[model samples]
Target: MLAVAMLLTLGLGGPWSGAEKAEAAPAFAKGADISWVPGMEAQGYTWKDKNGNTRDIIDILKNDYQINSVRIRVFVNPSNDYGNGYMNKDRAATLAQRAKNAGMSIMLTLHYSDSWADPGKQTKPAAWQSYTFQQLMDAVWNHTRDVMYAMQAKGVTPDWVQIGNETNNGMLWEDGKASVNMKNYAWLVNTGNNAVKSVSSGTKTIVHLANGYDNALFVWNIGGLIANGATFDIIGMSLYPTASDWSTKVNQTITNANDMISRYGKQVMITEIGLDYNQATAAKSFVTDIKTKIRNIAGGNGLGVFYWEPQASPGYNGGYNKGAWQSNGRPTIALDGFIN
Candidate 1:
């Protein structure tokens, strides 16, 4: 039993109950995106608990902080020559398995690109660059189906699946850019959602956008998706506030999230959120407050909050620095925000 506990603590073994385990399912999700785990591990980044004991970062979050879920990002065919590679389906599946074995709910986010896809850029995968808009839709559907099936084959059913990450501007470039062509974008989203349902009827589909603090943007983007008949179970947001305006942004995000639930009649999630290490206090306050507000959303429509790359290795050159860990692998107080 001690060995089992250690395995669970290290996230190397299947689920087991302890004093720390929640008596019931988490009322409001506490999540982290450990998508960079493989890359970080490959680069020889080590993680340890406050006591200085080496541990799996996922296990630390789940066992120590009450985090009940994890989010992973998948890139279709990312360049893997460098140790910094990501988005490959196989890597994602392996990580998903770890989360599943830890008994945490999994959220899979598909970028639908060969590299990063976000509000600023949504370049299509190179293989599909020559395909028409309709062909692109087919590709999206097939890829979604294949990924879902792959995870399912490993006994990892994603509780939530995001069609695209931070897609306020839309995905797949000009061919499926919602701002440029709402019809094509809507088609891609719906098709991706359908494919998720086909593979795992239990998985909830989400359409993510950046700037959770911007209500008008959500209104514009989500309104457009609805106007064009896009279907999804959840509306996802990426909330990253600077130190100067963190409180204001949090307030705005809460208001926006409530409005989205009331107007669109759909649930919402903080699909990605982060704060600088220097803002450790603010980070804790921000995470706790936003989670409280989300939990209090009228009708319980707010699903949860997820911190993006909270364990990011400082050595990586991807410009990510919102991790809750200090340089020595010990967690900063920023992670304390998840305690509640």
Candidate 2:
């Protein structure tokens, strides 16, 4: 009996002894871009937890969804357009403070425009439209620094800052259009990078682009930036796949993300991802697979995945249909992907 007790104590043999130590989960950021939260709230919208308890949106996200980070978009002099504008520096800083107070890492996306900036349109903010190349560079620097200062004054320093939003064809239109002049785009990217560093050297700067699965696009766009001496810490991607094609898209994105890591020798982040609001089941599967794949990237070069506006119910923002929230003021099961 003494020998058996020693064996069990030392884990030499026993039913529950010598159990393998559970490996700590990797620190892959699971987050959402809730830039639309303020606008939504202003419209008298509110959120509820799984238990039907009314709570602050951020509270619900952090406590219920296990979200570790939040992304906010900042625009240059946005209008009062509902769900379209109003992400100026002060507003952005307030949101950042809220996320920081909630113990969530913040990702600040500087659109550099008064409104949306994406693959289809990278229009310069109206104030910047008439500026020369040199003036444009100054505007980029000043704007970036100002926004960073605003956040800092609020005691909120972002963990990541995207220089531009989805610059597949390059940003600020004709002057910085990659197809027309890649070097100009590189200059703008470098200016933004420098500004971010000046404010918070620790913040990682991202050159965001759409279509994570398109290896050729990544090579052409990011390659252009590299060839023209652009500076950035991470390559950020945006991917939106429908319910039927998520599996294929996820696989392709993983392949592309690995290739980006190997080719660029830099980290990769899924800065934006979403599916139709009604497809909660498929969205859950999609998020789980993508998150797992991103976390498993070799050398831990895969940083994280961020869902775009997961709190928006169906048709909230001018018929936008990709959010993960249900119409009944609660999150759909889709966000369960973030759980370990």
Candidate 3:
């Protein structure tokens, strides 16, 4: 009993009279990709709770909706375009700090470009257009490290960092296209991975791809990366299913996630998911089912699920209709899936 008391007094075990308590292990992460919040707020947008009480969006997400994580995307040198740009490193770091202050974990996605990098497009940043292969690799490392340093300056260490966004065929165009030169893609992934580790070793690195339900694509993409000696900690995916097909897509995605875990021994994260704002009922069911299924993955290899820009209303960004927020400036029932 004396030893126990002494340990407690030393703040090593048990509750103390005044010392800070140890943080509990993080629960299954329910998250939101609200990278548009800053820009939206700047445009005079405000969020309201279900009861119509005006509140900070992050507060509503964390307190009312049970969202414990926030995913922010960082672009290298974004233009002033509202939807296509404005998420450069400094702004991202500021948003990350705000999310951290609200007691939410952070996931930093490095797009390595001025705009979107996805399955359909992976254009290199214009400044990096003239660089050779070696210079491109160096640019990747430097940009990643610089972003990490920016986050560090804000005293926010991201819990997870994605090297690229929805890189189905690979990123950085012809130089790093998987079909044409997978070795170059692998090298880029390694460079980003190494840069992230150099800043914060505890930050897990993710290589993301779109279409989480496509097992063959994952097999080809991830298998190629592994074959060419790519190193990463997690396999991230994007799943955007319509109201009618969500059930089927969710099941298929779960199967693909399991295969990824067993084949490569890496964890899986659903980095992006959404349904149309008008399909609130179906979206609720879809989110509930997918979250439950992902949590049930064997060995706890499933990391978390993040709704893509759930705060946007219809027509906010070039007719993006998939946001979970309603036109009345409140979240729809779709976000209720995270409440449990």
Candidate 4:
């Protein structure tokens, strides 16, 4: 049995026992963009009161809700400018410090891109726009090292890190795409693995995939990594109930999540999850179903849940892509329904 399962089993009564202590299912070890706060700070987005009160992420966590760990994304340079919101190193430090001061852990997610990178799209960061395969590998190595050094030097070391985000399709674009060449993919992955191995030896490295409910894809993508002998500590999945027929699909996701532990002999976590609180009723339904689904997953195999951007007020156009940050005219739908 996996250690997480064993630990979870060694509890009061059986799984459904009300007396049993139910641990929180954290959506992301830290959470998404909020995790990017540190990087945002590095890019020059500061929280300054009209009175000139300089408060960074620590204030948000300290005031809004208590946080234990932070998840930060490293983009090559999202805004193209030297300093902008899409995660530069300086912003990450400030948030990391807040997490540290608040006695929280840190999870580093290397997006391998300058801007938004997800299962839907994997645009290679412009800086690496023209690098050869080998050059790209070096970029990954140097970038990871530089970021880790900055965090560690400031006394904020991450407890967990991800080589790339939702790497189901592959990262670093046409070059790192799965069909391009398995050897190339392996090389890119190893570059990140070695980077973490070099600086934060204590950190658990994670490799993430998207659409947890899709069983065959999960097997194929992660199975490929295993075949190539890629080393990582965690198998992470992103579950967005609103993305599909969630209730029916969640069962498959649970099976896939548990199977990963057996398949890889490693821990698993719902590295990214959110029900799209765009509608309160839907949000409630999504939250209730997700809570049940996650409990089942945790019960069968030790795992965690991570809600993405739960606290984010709806962005302009209701967080639609290419939209600005504008209120969605709804009450803050707390994604913490499962974890909190």
TM-scores of the candidates in the order shown: 0.91, 0.91, 0.92, 0.75
Q: Give the per-residue lDDT digits (tens) of candidate 4, residues 1-340.
A: 1222222223322232232111233443434346534334454554532234555545544344334455677776767543334667766666666666766667778888877677777788787889887678778877877787777767876777788999887788888886566556656676676666565555677888888877788777777776775666788888766535666666777788778777778777777766554454555456556555655554344445555644343442125221111143222334334334
Q: Is candidate 3 or candidate 4 better by lDDT?
A: 3
Residues 1-340 of candidate 1 have per-residue lDDT tens digits of 2333223324353332221211233557799998878777888988988798999888899988888998988888888543575757878888898888998988899999988888889998999999977678778877887788778777787888899988887889888887789877887887787677655655788999999988888898899998988878899999999877888898999899989988999899998888997678999998888888888888888989999888875545556678888888888778788886
Alpha carbon RMSD to native, model 3: 9.1
Q: Give the TM-score of candidate 1.
A: 0.91
Candidate models: Cα lDDT each: 0.81, 0.85, 0.86, 0.61
Highest-TM-score candidate:
3
Least well predicted 10-residue stretch by lDDT in candidate 4: 317-326
Looking at model 2, the pairs that clash are: none
User: What tens-digit string does per-residue lDDT give for candidate 2 at 165-275?
Assistant: 999999999999999999999988887876776667668889999999999999999999999888889999999999999999999999998888888898999999999
Worst 10 residues of 2 by lDDT: 17-26
The per-residue C-alpha lDDT of model 3 at residue 216 equals 99
Clashes of each: 1, 0, 0, 16
> Candidate 2's error at 164, in angstroms?
0.4
Output the worst ten-in-a-row residue range by lDDT, candidate 1: 16-25
Error in Å for residue 314 of model 1: 3.3
Off by over 4 Å in 2: 1-26, 82-85
